[model samples]
Target chain A: MYRDPSDVNRVASLGAGPIGGGWTAHFLARGYDVNAYIHDPAERDALMAVVETGWVSLTGLGLALGASMDRLTVTSDLAEAVEGVGFIQESGPERLEIKQALYKRLGEIVPADVVIGSSTSGLTMTEIAAECETPGRCVIGHPFNPPYLLPLVEIIGGKQTDKAAVDWAAAFYEVAGKAPLVMKKEVPGFVATRLQEALWREALHMVANGEATPEDIDIALKNGPAPRMAVQGQCMAFHVACGEGGMATNLDQFGPALKWPWTRLEAPELTKELRDQMVDGCNAMAGDRHFRDMAAERDRKIVAVLKAVRDG
Target chain B: MYRDPSDVNRVASLGAGPIGGGWTAHFLARGYDVNAYIHDPAERDALMAVVETGWVSLTGLGLALGASMDRLTVTSDLAEAVEGVGFIQESGPERLEIKQALYKRLGEIVPADVVIGSSTSGLTMTEIAAECETPGRCVIGHPFNPPYLLPLVEIIGGKQTDKAAVDWAAAFYEVAGKAPLVMKKEVPGFVATRLQEALWREALHMVANGEATPEDIDIALKNGPAPRMAVQGQCMAFHVACGEGGMATNLDQFGPALKWPWTRLEAPELTKELRDQMVDGCNAMAGDRHFRDMAAERDRKIVAVLKAVRDG
Candidate 1:
């Protein structure tokens, strides 16, 4: 059953690293009580700042939220955060054991009806669900970063996951004003992450093999195909890009090029040399911004673009 | 040199198919003297009507030019269209031989100074330029369909093509209110079309292979990734989608899946079996709408979304 937005008395974020904090801010902005848990002491202030910045940005975008900033409660204890929560978002480290243990703890305490979701990139739900007593209650509620603005959530289920449980989580995300897509089965990386990884791997391989500059690869996507893709999904964009003859004609024509030597699906392992090359390429491609600052900057830009779309 | 919008006299479209007609309308709507040469007799009235309809749409969107509607001229005579033209756009069939022969004819008559461009999907400038007497002047000026609405033009050059020619075409398209991206080297399908074809081929393969239904595939993109992608380009979208860890972590953790069998690189042959599968799948997905009408309706919706972005 989907929790009514008005009925959500408390919301808990199990991991208050950058992403977890964002989730906390999202619930808080919507007037739901937030219990955010973070393990790293050094990260506490930064994560809190992230939540505040996100709240400020959302308000700046004129998004109406009836909640006050005081609704947020940050804690170091997981059980304290999970108590009386209608929804729990786990944004722990991507490691399987860490997630498994977190789910076990949360599953033991949170009400049986509460929805449990993971911010996992691509790890299997079957594996993650192994930690919970009510395994069926655990679903992959994968959200893109700065969760408040980017409206995407991949809802996937594991072998033991109940259909009702997945549906409940999906419904809750929808009520939270997030665009949620349900995956039929548990797949590694789910869908969006898988497609992205494939593209990223190829892009890196191009740099590793010296086919193109790191900057060119990014520019190739950003200034080139990216604009068209913004409006049309990759497949639909190709349907138009290849003309009305559609996928059949395009496949027939470009199918031979799939075997092109330039497209290196397999590159050398990321040894010290490869790592240096990759880092250099990425640093050159992205310029001088540090990762966190870049990520926050990206989130701000996403908000600006989303606000433009909303206003228009 | 950019074609002066105020000083523009004649605009020629060498092959006026639907895409060509869009370019034709773009020039005419910008108050230039538009001339088109189309092979099919039945296309004349329809093309003219489309141009008129496009003018109305542009005016409604507050992007209209003061050009008279009756100024659009369609003729069977290719020579007549090219005579004294300041700019030329070729949107003929994708057959390389046909394009080569047509370019030869165009080369003989069109003045040396006139900027000529081919809107060929995958055909490279090198191949098209080889047939021209003044090969150095030939360049690929590929535009996204519904050119009057989509502002992108991929300006790519062949080995022998002159840099001045590509720059001129870029400036002209910019003056005509289009964003032109220059490709350093000519590749099949250029940038947008290549990425599009790659994703499309995989999507069709997935449908053919029984992984997902057509409607679900469309839903997965439109409601989920496409909305976010509409704001950020694909690379940046991935940067955001990967959460706090960013592309490096995303690549290392999920990169192995690039070689996974999830994507069918070799699609099933387009036999009667595949045709039936596609027709049935798409028809069931689209429900009651005929394909042509559905395509037109889709275009209209895209125009609305694009106008939101452009005017917003």
Candidate 2:
């Protein structure tokens, strides 16, 4: 049964895994007809369940775009998913070969005008576009996790990605009620991940070195900039830290001290020793809680908090 | 006129100048003795007017720590400000020599254990620490702007810093109801600034190259992970991005792809032309609004948003 197609744009999530499912929820809740494709047939039910729950939450929050599961179609065929879609979000396995094959196939079947984006955190737009026939039409529309809630989508370009393609993807994401930032050029991990990795790497190093407890380190972020960062980006955050002097004043005063010996820039060789330490450290820190449960708790609180912000 | 020092633990901010005054307000409002240091001498009355306005708005929202500005002290003398004070958060000039001279004087007169912390964003802890005779004791308790609202404080280490000094400072901040994360080793820009700089550099590069408009870039952050990050750290944020795959699944799937040349690692040589483009781009994007007003608005919304989340 078809609802108003005019009200619901035809959108497809190229990989119906968890990220793909999130993409599905985001679009479907916004009244888009979602065509979700997943390689593993067994997980289809579970995936759909997640989508349903997402719809419930979105509807409760009044963010639901009046769409329902009746509009969602699950499939394994790439062509079936891509046909007549206005926007396509590919969240397949991150392997270049796998993505290349998938995109090459998608390029052949999907209409040329459709905006195709990859939920890749690592691969450059160039790498993703290399395999596509009309490389300029494909771009990276990397979103933060649980796309239904978070609004950031880093719009990056592959080597051959046309400027128009990036602009188109940004506009599409905006229309989707998503926040989209277009990168000047391709970069690993884009903006957010790279900043995060730097801090994470430092945390890992601290855990490895035994300078402070994991609890202490985590407490630092939870209690501090992580919250402020929710509102202000880093530079502005520091600019504020520097008070009226702005960044230049901050730099001239504090920049030289960074030359000390403590900051180990070289990535720790993730030897078995480092790996074991990480595994042990994280497990010990997390305790008996499953990561999924932890993630859910995180999401629930984030949603609750964001909702509070929205309402206030 | 003696205001009760007992209620003095309740702090009130007089000016919304930079978010520094807001940080001072955070401590005082949270049940600490605060004498807010407003830079403008003539605007003392005007500043108090500003503080009174915020008081009605903020306290009405129940943010005051069981007390209100009835306990606050507004003073011009740096010495009188810290007299009988448990902590002094000096967010004055960002100039190194100026701040150094101020802290040096503060070091000579203020009670030895009063825990002097500057909100210096980029200044090295070593240099700031060097101003005091008891060098190790002085530390940088850098907070993100809008500290009264957000919970991040980058506890940095300087050269000649004693281990206990960092701990003591951390403890003091924690007791003050702030989350203080101690950097294992001193890094330039600390953990947050460095990562933020990396992202900003890339953004500048994009603007210089004419890839995307500033509004589009800012929208990317505002609408996306900037909001999500309020609750979760970056590592976990990415974990969520991988959906239910958790960190392991996510790392496995996306790890290999990270090797791609997606990041503009080579620092953008900020040519004169590039710098001009960046300034112009950002200025046009920001429009005619004063940065301070812009910042105050951001903090107000942030406080509201965070409070909403807290209530939710």
Candidate 3:
């Protein structure tokens, strides 16, 4: 069952570090009572320090209805950390044995209904779920660096995971001001990491081949394609490329380039769902403008940008 | 010698298509007297419409000093268009024969001292210059789409091209309210297109695979990576990723990811120049703060964002 945000007043964060500390701070700043715990009691000072430092940034981000630093309860024992908590965020060491054991033990203590979110970078839920008796309660809540800062939280459910758990976490995250990207299926690296990996790899390739300097690479993005990305995503950008032609025109062009091996990657076959999504996104960004008119208007508005960076 | 902006008041546009029209509008809006010519006089009406339409956006972007749409003079004759002009921008078809023939003709009309810049997207300067008698006066001044708005103009010199011509074009572009991305050497797709191509290919791959819908892909970037890119480039983003360790730490972590077959594209070996550029770019972005501090600051600032997106 999808738990209501109001019902999740207290959340538990295990294995406090940079990500865990940030998550704790976020929960606290969002007016939730966060019961935070680490592997050992000796790291209490460091954990609190991370939360305090993170608090400054969170406060800057603006506090919620009852947000406060005082709402955080630091615990030494794992069971004590989970005490009376409605939700669990596991940010433990990225080790198989430790996490497998931790989840198994936590599963016995916490109620079967409570959803446990792991902040694993690469570990799949299928592997971690094996250790949990209530496997349905476990899910992946992989966050980018600085959890309190970056708004993205990629949610992926593995084999033996319940849809309810994923839904609960996604709903909870939306209420908490995070952009929860819930994947339909488990994909390696997820969407953000995979896309970033592709771009980064190409960048490295160019640099290694004496193609361009790092500064040169960065400046190009800052000035050109990235500004468009800042406003629109890659699919929409291609949609805009079609001028009045829309997605069909884009695909027509994309077809030749796909075969060219332009950037070392090959494209998957064009499915109807992907095409429809591409077209719909462009229409949304297009607003009242006709498909063709959107292109003219796009080119027009782009021609009229305010002096973002003035030259002396 | 860098020609004075005043001495270069009269500029010639050797094509009146989209790019040519955009260039004409930009020059006119920047207060330069422009002599614009296309292949046919019948296209004059169409070209002027493009400029007039582009002017609305140009005015919104804020016109340059003494900028006016009234200063544009459209001509059908090639010699008449280039007569007594300080600089000539060729916006011809991407055909080898057409560009070769046009540049050869324009080279004869304009003095050897007047720099002629080509708007060829992918054509090398070496190929285009071979057609020109005074190749020293020819250089690549490739502008991004919707040139009147976007500030980027990648300036590349050919194998036989003179540095003086490149320098003059760069100075002129800066004076024209364009970001002159002066290249150290010529590479395929230059910096902007290369990076864009890389990003675009991955987007296509994702769409083809049915792993995620197009809307999902766009939203992921718009809400996640693009914002960082809008404010800072990729190199700086990685520097911030190092937490407090800075570039050194980033490299250490990136070292493993680089080896991973995360993307279909393979990374070139990390040569010294590539490594140094990455480090230096990060250091520059880091500024006074050590790399570790940047991570703390990045998190803090991100936390402080009162809903990063305010505009509708």
Candidate 4:
């Protein structure tokens, strides 16, 4: 049987690119001994440079007990890197064939009980693990860029992935100080990327239409919605914005505006079913907190964020 | 000639709803003597309540010299509110007819040189200023909710508006502590709202499709891109993420992802013209700073913001 995630103290970081190096730095800071694998030995200096840069920010965020850069080891041999590591993170190039072949090798080398999490932002794990003999252990543990600073880690499983593997990965990432979102269904771009792409495409359209410059769009966002969003996401922010009435009042007031030609993307029809889902979801998110209290908390956090950005 | 925006110390804030009341509190905190007009006498207390709520945040952000809530004066009579004010901000109901009639009365009551800035989120300046005789001085000064905290104020002008009016509104908003984006062309939702709506609609689709819940989406955003966005907007953030190569490297690496079916919105074709526009815009935004320096600055600011949010 695979050791519990909390009992696994060593990790294998496969790939020497930005994402892999970031994972190496983060794991080391969390007091884990890391084995980092690279295809080209000449890229060793570049990977270490990435780790050195990441270490500054990690130190600022604080290090775990016994955390040290010396705990990391680099190797060019694939089998050597996977030896005795409880967890394996694969962040190779985005090409499907490259990832499939790598996963096939990883499945043969690593213990069957160990979980292998791919960090591919584009390719789904189902496709990447197609050649793997032990596909049930392969899952997606994607992170945003500069993974050392950002806390999000999206956990998704392939069609052949076992539920136990997904749960194990989630628990491991939590212990590693990550905010994990274990997806229930596979979709293109998952959640955050889809939302980000939507916003980014609209920004490009505005520039194409000569409505605003890129700088104008960025300034508007950083100064307007971004700070508040850092405190609370869009749904909860609007829920709090409506004050005591919460999201129900927000829907009544702004639902019609959703039909306006505000964006190029077409909105889903606000069906009764969809409306209830939204209201219920927001209520679940709010739990017992009153709208007034949430709004106040949001305002307080936004003030702090604004000050931080300004002072920095 | 109208008094210079820097010399405008007294302003009229018409309407008493959330937007108007937010403007009232902001102006008062900036040390401007504000005359607020409401249609209903019963709303006076409610208006003050909004101001009181805003005052807590405004004070936390630091009050300007000589700033005090006592500088605000409430009146039900529209004429009394406009009397002797140097600038006017109209935040009445969203109906075009109501706004047109209000603008007509505002044009007749205030001097032609005094710029009338509307805070409508939906209606365009051209449509709202249609019935006004002094349309040349009418402009849009739309602010996000809780204008006292968020610094962005998008300034737009109608076809009848003078260039001087747009410039004047931008200057006045800056003097009142706003990061103003003076738009070059009129669009339906302006810059920020279009971007925000695109993201929001996509989020709704995700929830509707049962891919994720509202809480899941919120957790993904708050932990992923939102905090970094608070420090820098998307364009600059991506530019810095590519390291020494800047935006050019970023485009070469990830531009293909734009063609992927990641979002429901159709992206504009990545023509050379658009590419050059984006690259040039980012280069101009970067100015004299090297990519490494900017990345360091971004990391520092993001760290501060994350710490602030976590502590709060």
Q: Is candidate 3 or candidate 4 better by TM-score?
A: 4
Tens-place lDDT digits, model 3, residues B89-120: 88989898888888788767778888889999
Clashes of each: 2, 25, 7, 0
Give the per-residue lDDT digits (tens) of candidate 4, residues A211-276: 889899899889998998889988898888888878788777778877989999999998778787
C-alpha lDDT of all candidate models, in order: 0.61, 0.58, 0.76, 0.89
DockQ of candidate 3 (2 decimals): 0.49
Q: Which digits, one per residue and each the tens of the lDDT, describe model 4 over residues B1-312? A: 667788888999988898999999999999999999999999999899889999999998899999988898899999999999989999999999999999988888889999999998877888888999999999999998778789999999988999999999999899889999998787878888888889999988988889888888888889888888778798888888877777777776778878888989988988788888888999999999998888888878887888878886
> Which prediction has more favorable DockQ, 3 or 4?
4
lDDT of 2 at A13: 90
Which residue pairs in candidate 1 have backbone atoms (N, alpha carbon, C) closer than 3 angstroms, thus clashing?
A122-A189, A230-B230
Q: Which wins on lDDT, candidate 1 or candidate 3? A: 3
Tell me how each candidate scores on DockQ against the true complex.
0.07, 0.13, 0.49, 0.82
Residues A1-312 of candidate 2: C-alpha lDDT, one tens digit per residue: 122224337898977665787788888877778899888778698788667655544554345546777888888877777887777898988899988888888778877777788998767767776778977788888887556556678887777877777888877787777777777555556665554544544544444444534444445554544544454344434444443444445445654433433344432233344333323433443457554444333333343443444343
Q: Please list, in the order the candidates appear, how each scores on TM-score for chain B only.
A: 0.73, 0.72, 0.88, 0.97
Query: Model 1: per-residue lDDT, tens digit, A1-312?
Result: 445644767888867566787787777776788888887656679778768756754554344357767887888877787888888888888899888887787768877778788888757779897878888788888875446545568888788888998888878887776767787555555555444444544444333433433344444554344434444445444333443344444445654654543233322232344233323333443355454343333323322333343342
Question: Which prediction has more favorable DockQ, 2 or 4?
Answer: 4
Docking model 1 quality class:
incorrect
lDDT by residue for model 2 (B52-131), tens: 53343344334644655656777666656667765567676667897777767877876665556778875876776567
Sort order, DockQ high to low: 4, 3, 2, 1
In Å, what is the interface RMSD of model 3? 3.9
Best by TM-score: 4
| Best-first order by lDDT | 4, 3, 1, 2
